[model samples]
Target: MIGILAAAALQADAPVEWTALQQDNIQVAELAYDVGIALAVICRDDQLMVAITGLPDPAPGAKFRKLEVNIPGAELQASTWRIQGKATISLAPAVYARRLRTADHLTVRAPAEEGEPARRYELALPSDHLALDQTLEACDVPLVLETDLTYDPTISAVTWATSPRITPPNRLPPGGYAEVVLECTVGARGRPENCRAIREQPANSGFARSALLSIRTGRLGLIDGGPPPVGGVFRTRLTINVVN
Candidate 1:
């Protein structure tokens, strides 16, 4: 009983931050509640997060879990990573933000595992969407929160002047296939910068690591029609299929 009161007091005293704030080169916009839950967008990494404070550690060898996320009319499944008590989702950041922008509340359901009963949490969100907007803006992702994304970025006219070497992982199965989607920024001289994997197949396979290496040396070639505006988002998938 006393502990519950203490938690409530802590919640009341905590400062409210609804805008994207920078700390140590990483920018984030988040909404936290007294229930020990927070919805966050980590801009530098281009990932969404559901942070639950004081959550217990997972059993050994657990890599990920499917979390059910609920907004107005959609019930989405999130592949969540348990990191320091937070459920981090590393899929399409822009799409996630767009769906969340107009939501009045967010609900997360954690399915029961290993005999533990399932758990559910519902949280209210602000009507104003300044923070969410900032996240998309910071990454130069298109503004589609108000409407469906109709704009497809043009990379066709652009060529790779200095491109990274996409190679198959050394330990990959002889006849296996792997792919990774990278979110990168078009830096000076059309080179890709700050690239990170947003999706990967066969988790723990070295595909994601290799893909990053491939982008490390990639540079775009363009003229009148070109890659996304310098600093705009550039997403590309790297694939390796080794057939015997």
Candidate 2:
């Protein structure tokens, strides 16, 4: 029985103290709350609390606060890995205005009518938190941290890349080689929204462009709840035989 107890104690996960983000006298454009830099974040038994170094009155020009939390992925019962938590933040207009912008990019396109400044289509977060729990199971640790920043919905461009590839036409002269890279942007919906070729290789440009298009069409498995604030890319070199 003692062995079981010892093992249980060993198996118990320790709370993660993300001390790296602690700071002081910081200016918050979102919330009326003033926060100093030094911060003390404690997590234990599925509970979390953050104590900032300073809390001042809302600045005249400033309206809200951006509460930044870094969530870390962990190993569950067996091969299963997951992350779970709850965040109760103050989201008044003054406090949330700045925080929302911090969430993702808010673009303003030309309005349908003449007098309108523009139209806004804000990114949507998943309504299902349970789904988010499942998707995080297979994602890397960095992904969890990245997702936390996305919750605010005020973020802009989220980006990640893969390796490069090389493909050559079989009919090429004796000496022939090709290598190129394709970069793309994933929209808030967890799919490649845009793509661009970075390297210049005339022979492989066409092929690269096609491959980039394929990537743009591909979908990324996301937390069922919503799209993250950032995008991810898979880059690699490919060798395709050219038919001459």
lDDT of candidate 2 over 1-244, digit per residue (tens): 1122222223223221121221142211111111112222222233332222222222233222232222111111111111112112222122222223233322212123334333322222223233223222222212123323223222222232432233333344333434345555556655656667565344543555555645554454432122434565433233344544
lDDT of 1 by residue, 12-87 (tens): 4344446566766456666656655556666665534323332333444454444566532455454343434234
The runs of at least 3 residues in candidate 1 whose Cα sits more than 4 Å from the true structure, single-residue gaps closed, are 1-19, 45-57, 71-73, 76-87, 145-244
lDDT, each prediction:
0.59, 0.31
* Best lDDT among the predictions, by candidate number: 1
lDDT for 45 in candidate 2 is 31
Candidate 2 worst ten-residue window by lDDT: 74-83
Clashing pairs in 1: none
lDDT of 2 at 49: 29
